[model samples]
Target chain A: MKRAAAILGIGTDHVYEVDPDESGRVSAEKMEEKILYCQELGFSVFFVGITAGTTVYGAFDPIEDIAIICRKYKIWLHVDGAWGGSALLSPKTKHLLQGIDKADSFTWNPHKLMSIHLQCSAILIRHTNILMQANQMCAGYLFQPDKHYETSLDTGDKTIQCGRHIDILKLWLGWKARGHQGYAEHIETLLEKANFFYEIISKREPCFRMVIKPPFINVCFWYVPPSLQNIDQTSLEYNERLDKIAPRIKERMMTNGTMMVGYQRLDHHPNFFRAIISNPATTKDDIIAMIDEIHELGHDL
Target chain B: MKRAAAILGIGTDHVYEVDPDESGRVSAEKMEEKILYCQELGFSVFFVGITAGTTVYGAFDPIEDIAIICRKYKIWLHVDGAWGGSALLSPKTKHLLQGIDKADSFTWNPHKLMSIHLQCSAILIRHTNILMQANQMCAGYLFQPDKHYETSLDTGDKTIQCGRHIDILKLWLGWKARGHQGYAEHIETLLEKANFFYEIISKREPCFRMVIKPPFINVCFWYVPPSLQNIDQTSLEYNERLDKIAPRIKERMMTNGTMMVGYQRLDHHPNFFRAIISNPATTKDDIIAMIDEIHELGHDL
Candidate 1:
């Protein structure tokens, strides 16, 4: 999003990031405040983007409140649901994204949660005519008027690209094979696994420290080694040592071909692991094995 | 390229296009005149793009002269060799791109003449460091410093795309299967077929008007019927009648599944067919069959 804005001549200073709460979800009040501040400065609020599911933590932003603000300001609301948009298919969790229809535009990558092949993503706009107006390049040679069929169906002018890979076929076929009900069941199962992992990690006490309650399918926690279990986390030495643990464990995991997990330090927080359960095939045993493997690899450190 | 410049806040009025010569290649003098004019208007001449092989007529721009002008003005010279870059492998035609080594950047599509699968294109830059400097985004989560392997090998930082398809393997394996010598032979064969087709069309006189001697593997000619042979080509009625022939023949070809050819009206020229011989399997018999099929389909018209 920053790169896109930068490309359009928007400086980094103009891009204001509204911070997320303790649960990693952006606050509705904070967003409204930012919008009001921008208006006060006589700036036209053109775009307001809400991350439906953040990459580090699979937390959904409060879409209902964001949509209301967008409507009031007449700003284009874009929902970046690249990671968690598939959850809308699940009847149980669809309420998480209740006001998704109000968004002016939304981006959803089927490859992530749906487990479809990579490079399958859709950017849907509520006003498709606006999209055409922005992208149409009437190249005379390709989009010919003398075609036998309807020329409106020639989608070449509707995209920034002249030639695009046929990635939609794979996504369409995969969706057909696994019906809507199948996807809902898969999403529900993955969330259940995440909750199950969270419970186990909580019971393990000092060995594993839960960063936050499992919001979506992402369970972020720090695998506290025996040496740092008793130390104050806010201490400089403790954080310095904690930062090195995930990288070292990741190195060992790669060498042994064991379980794989991602780790990153957000803001002032120390390095912590982010375990995502997107694959429905991932069993409870697999989650348990990951915890055991991390312990075994980083016990000495 | 215009759209990209527009996005970067450069208006259409700022863009100046120098017309190509009668041979469809941009003349060096015309290019220099445009550059001097832009400079006179107090515009910073940033880029000058030369089409190595024009789509309508496969004409090679005088790269040697253009490169010298670019050097003199300290401007970036980008060669759009998307259609004809593969000719570099052929010993006979490599001289056409004599000063390609001096170009600041060049775009080549392996999908065109190389017969590699679609979506395989490369932009070769003279300065590798500048590319990295322009594209590098220090994303903390992805480009980690503590990686086991050399992190510099991670190409993710050096591209605009976050997730890219693994297209390199196909190009690499295809290049390996057919070595440099094999490509040279293939290119030479295609050029020979193009010349053969040109000779055949030239013999047919008024029935097939040759659209300049093809510089590359594109054989462009008008498949004029017997009725329009005596008419002056410059006449409005003649051009109007001539424009209808290719489309009518194309419709018949599609319905009969005899042969497929592309047609377009370039500049002030009437509608003409552009037959390309990129396929290695194309034989003299196939070329003869196409000519016979066109006559059979459009003889009465």
Candidate 2:
């Protein structure tokens, strides 16, 4: 989202930020504070982006509260539900994205959690003709106003691309094959598996530490080796050692051809593993095997 | 390219143009004049875009001549070969892109002339690491500096997209299946077919009019219906009548479910058909059939 803003010539200086809370979720109060600050400096805050699922901790920002603020200011509320939009398919998980329908626009990626093919994403706008107004090149060769058929149905003028790939066909086929019920079941199963992992890691105590209670399918945790088990949590030595553990264990995992899990340092926290349960094919045994492999690789470090 | 510039906040005010000559090729003198004019107004003329194969005319800009001016002005020279870059494959047509190697960067889409699957495109840079420097986010989770292997080869940081679809695999497979020699032959054959179409249209005088001598595999021409056959070319009535012919013929073509050809007005010319011979499956019989179909559907109009 920041990259997209940068491409549109909005430099870092122009981008105001509201830091995430301890749970890694953007708070409504913080967002309103930032908006007020920017406005005080004579900035017209036209767009307010609220992420449904953040990248690191699977955090879902309070969209309902933020939407109220956005409505008060008459700002365009855009929800980037790229990672968490699929949760809306399941009745049990739909509450996480509570105020998404109230958004002026929403970005959803079927590729992330829906397990559709890569690059399958959509931006749905509430108003009609706005996209065409913003992106139309009016290339006479392509979109002729005097065509026999209705030119309004010709959506090519609604985006920057003159020639787009048939990405929709695959998404449609996938959706048809897996009906709404099938998709709901898929989401429920992934969430169950993620919850199971979180519970297992929580019980493991000093050996493993849950960074925060995961709100989505991402289970982020730190595998504390025996050497640093007794180290004081506040000491510089503990975090310094904890930071190096994830990379070392990751290297071993890759070298051994066991499993692939991403690790990274998040605000104030050292390097930790972020296990995503998006794949439906992952078995219970596979999850156990992943836990066992991490233990075997990092226990003595 | 203009869309990309617009995305980067380079509006029409910043975008200066050096108009193409009669054949639709960008002359070096005109480019130098435009650059000097922009510089005189205290505007930094930093980039000069030279098209290897323009979309409408299939005209290759004089790259060798333009490169000298770009070098003199210390400007970045980018060649948009989205339409015509495949000419470099054939020895017969390679001379058309003589000074492409001197360009700072070149965009080539294999999906165009190469007949590869859609969305297979690449931007070739003259220097290495520049792309990484410009686009890297240094996201600690993805691009770790202290990885066991050479992290420099990790190309995810070299673009705005954190997760890009593997567009290179299909392109690589297509290249492998069709060797360099086979590709050259494919390009040469397409160019030959385009030339044949051009020849046939040129001979069909009163019924047809060649827009310009095509430089590459895009044969642009006009279907002069019986009503406009005797009309004076300079009159407003002739151009107005001419302009409506293509849309009418195009509507008929779509309704009849025959060949698909794009039509557009360029510069002072009225609507003309741009028949591109890019697909290897297009045969000589098909070319003849297209011309016959256009006449059968349009000549009376």
Candidate DockQ scores, in order: 0.53, 0.61
Q: lDDT by residue for model 1 over B1-301, one digit each (tens)? A: 6656666567556778889877889988999999999999999998999978877788889999999999999999999898888889889989889899999999988888888887788889999677668766676755677878887777877877788777777789888999999999999999999989999998888788887888888888898999998998789999999988888888899889877898887778777889998899989999989998998999899
Cα deviation at A270, candidate 1, in Å, is: 2.0
lDDT of each: 0.85, 0.88
Question: TM-score (0 to 1) for chain A, all models?
Answer: 0.97, 0.97
Shift of residue B110 alpha carbon in model 2, Å: 0.5
Q: Model 2, range A121-229, lDDT digits (tens) per residue?
A: 8888998789887777677656668777887988788887778787878789988999999999999999989988998898887898999998888999999999999
B-chain TM-score, candidate 1: 0.96
Candidates in order, TM-scores: namely 0.96, 0.97
Deviating ranges (above 4 Å) for candidate 2 = none
Error of 1 at B90 (Å): 1.8
